[model samples]
Target chain A: MKNRVRYTFILPALILMTIIVAFPIIYNLYMSLHIWFVASGSGPHWNGLKNYIALLSDKRFWNSIRVTIIFTVGALGSEVLIGVLLALFFNRQFKGKDIIKTIFLFPIAATPVAVALIWGMMYNYDLGIINVLLKAIGLPPLLWLADPKWVIPALIITDAWQWTPLILLIVLSNLESLPTDPFESAKVDGANSLQVILYITLPMVKPAIIVAAMIRSIDAIKTFDLIYVMTQGGPDIASENLNLYIFNMGFSYFRMGMASTLAIVLFTIVMAVNVFLAVIRNRDVT
Target chain B: MSKSYIKTGLFYIGIAAITILPLIVFLWMFLTGLKTQMDNLAIPPKIIFSPTLQNFKSVFAQNNFLKYLFNSFIVAVFAVAISLLFGLPAAYAIARFKMHKIGLTLLIARMIPFISYLIPWFIIFRKLRLVDTYIALITTHLIITLPFIIWIMVNFFENVPISLEEAARIDGCSYFQVFVRILIPVVRNGIFTSSVLGFIFSWNQFLFSLILSGNRTMTVPVAVFKFISYEEINWGGLAAAATTITLPPLILTLFIQKHMIKGLTSGAVKG
Candidate 1:
């Protein structure tokens, strides 16, 4: 009876997780086996891996994968590099550290919707501040989301702006946690700031770096809000990511089976990245 | 001495500018919210516009703004509650037992691209006639909240030693008793952290609520999205609506700024 009751609390969560979380994941696989659309109506009709096969052949699918790679690498690269630098800069005790830390919290709590809106306005070609500033500086105004060439770069910048703080916060905490003995010894040896950081701090924070990289990469891979709001995978799907492609498939095109296939593919890719990280972490743990 | 001061001042300037750019833009939006459409659109950008309550008046008068607000509230609140209920015990299990695989899985669930599930779940919810319902909205919101709860709470629960619960057990408490009587108190910070993250994530969720919620159940994000469409973009109304939708979360963010910052990245970078 006691065991049963203990199970009660755990059971509800397990059941809910199974139903809500696990179910959609499982159902996506089931749906992916079909060649169905909105006309398939209530439940998707099975075509037994045809959708997956189609996804393999689809140019649109390949394009999305390429775009997703660019987005993932671009966003994660800046987030990690800039994040490490920002964390280091803020690590030293300084006046207004508390206030700066608080301000650094903006991108995290600033709703993606609002961030996208503000970015959208900033990226606007004509009346936006960016263009205005460019004009004032005697530089040519670049169309941020209009031209396909610059759209991805613009998104990368905005994404970096929003997420670097997240990585910075994480790495800063990790830096604070580092054993200071080595650093103190290094300082006693008259090592420079750059040498101390490069020699001691960097190596010590590897786990934190890995964790930050993993988390940021995951978030970057799944970016939907800023892209959806700012560009909607536009200027001819220049910014269409896997997530946006999935959104378009499901909502705009109503290709339920194809969308499920895309969703499952995205999930598989994310899992691969995660598994790779986990293996590295496990190796480190040993 | 002069060079050092110049460099220090430049560093401060750079940091401040980097941080303040978005704030200035957000302030512009807030200021636009307080301006008449004509004042808002003026060229040379009347950095000082004649403020008016007219936009707020029309926004509330025109849209079912409160209903949308209530929808956001309902979804955010219940989603937090449900995610906590589902997440806490699992988090507790992961913390005490070190169930690494399960923990990883939960994190992955939280991090998974949400848009992937939008249509698949939409069809299922429609089949069950649960689409656009509060149940659907709140449940769908679990996609955002539960993983956050699990991730945040796991770190908190991990920091708490199991010996306290062992003491409760030796005092003749059941496992549930230990959880209810002991673990909850020690992990209150974790609970608060998870709640804030959950609430914010739910509040910010767009794709699910957009497709899932019908006319009666529209959310602030989608409602803001509605202000711009094919026929004609209502630039003034859109900006006003964006500002209005953004204010509550921004205010809420400031109110809980400390917790919000700690909550967002603390788990991933444990000391």
Candidate 2:
């Protein structure tokens, strides 16, 4: 009786998950094996591996993959770097520190669509504030979202602005919880601040930093709203990440089978990164 | 000593810049919402202007923004409420019984792209004639809120003393009764944190609602796009709409910052 009761406790959630999460994933797999276009008004018919073969040769698909890799690496690299530097700066006591921390939390919590929209306006060529500031500094105002060359970097800046705070918060929390004995000993040994940080602080915070990077990487690869709202994968598909490509395939083109295949590929990529990071984290522990 | 003072002054200046720099976009958004179109489009970007409530008035008067706001509220509330109901007991069971597989399953479910789920959900709901209904939106949002609630609550449940449950059991309290009378009260803070976080996730959710919901159930995030068209974009109206949409989550996050940080970093740091 005791053993069975716990199962009952989980039953409702299990059932809900099966209906909502499990069923969709299975159905997506099944759909990926078919050739169906909803716009054609014909139901799905099995065409095993054709969609996959087509995807293998799809140049647009490959471009999206490239874009995704660049976005992920660029955004995640910057976020971690900036986040760590900011966290180190903030770990010390200062005036209005708590208020500053609270302000940091606002960007992460703000709505993504709204954030994208605000950035879109600010990226405007003629009247936007970013270019205004650039002009004020005596630099040329580049076409931010309108130019293919500058689109990805522009998007990266927006993404970094919004999510860097998350990495900062995670690292800051870890920094606070660390033991003081190591720092005390390092000071007694007459080490400089940079040396102490490089030798002791960073190594101790490695696990937390890895975890933060992993979380940010997973979310960053799946970024959609910001791309969709700001550029809509425009300027000749310059900023179209895999997520946006999959969305266009499914909804705009109504090619459900192709869309499902793209989603599976994305799923595989995300899971691979997740497992890879988990393995590294586990290795650090042992 | 004089050099050290200079360093301290630079440090304060750097900290202030870091803190205030990122917030300029938000400040710009709020200020633009108060500007007339002429002021908004001014080349220098008007830093000082006679602010007007016209944009806010037009957002409500011209677009049916209040309805979208209501839709967002209703969907988020129902989704969070349902997630809490199913997630609390499941979290307790997983924590106490060492159900690690179940916990991992929930985490994987959370990590899957919302687009993957949106494909089948669009098909199923279309067939059921449930598109544009609250039922479809709330149910799909469970894919977000349920996993989030369970993941956060499991951490809270693990921290509770098993002795408390055992004592209740010895006192002739049934498992369900002990869960209700003892564990529920013990992890109320976790419950609050998860609910707030879940509600915010659902509220901010755009893709699911965008594909699944029609005009009748359009959310605030989706509604912001109405101010944009191919012909021309309504800058004042768009700014007002965006500002309105971001306000609730910003306010809620302010109240729960400490708990929210702990919740966000709990599993990531430990594992």
After TM-score superposition, the amount by which residue A17's alpha carbon in candidate 1 deviates from its true location, in angstroms, is 0.1
Look at candidate 2 and tell me the lDDT of residue B6. 100
Worst 10 residues of 2 chain A by lDDT: A92-101
Residues A60-143, model 1: lDDT tens digits? 888899999999999899889999988887787667877777777766666677678767776777667778788888999999
Candidate 1, residues B1-271: lDDT per residue as tens digits? 9999998899888778766854676676667667666764555556765677777777788778788988998899999998888889878876676766766666667656686657667887887998878888888898778777877888888888768877889999988888888889888977876787678778878888888998788888887676556312344556677787776666666656666655766545431
TM-score of chain A of each: 0.95, 0.98
lDDT per residue as tens, model 2, B1-271: 9999999999999987898866888988999889998998787877779999999998888667899999999999999999999999999998999898888887688668889999999988988999999999999999999988888899999999999999999999999999999999999989988888888888899999889888899999888865665314568878888899999999998878888877876655444
Q: Give each model's clash number.
A: 0, 0
Candidate 1 off by > 4 Å: A1-6, A40-43, A280-286, B1-8, B230-234, B259-262, B266-271
- Provide chain B's TM-score, model 1: 0.90
Candidate 2 pairs with clashing backbones: none
Error of 2 at A142 (Å): 1.0
Model 2: lDDT equals 0.90
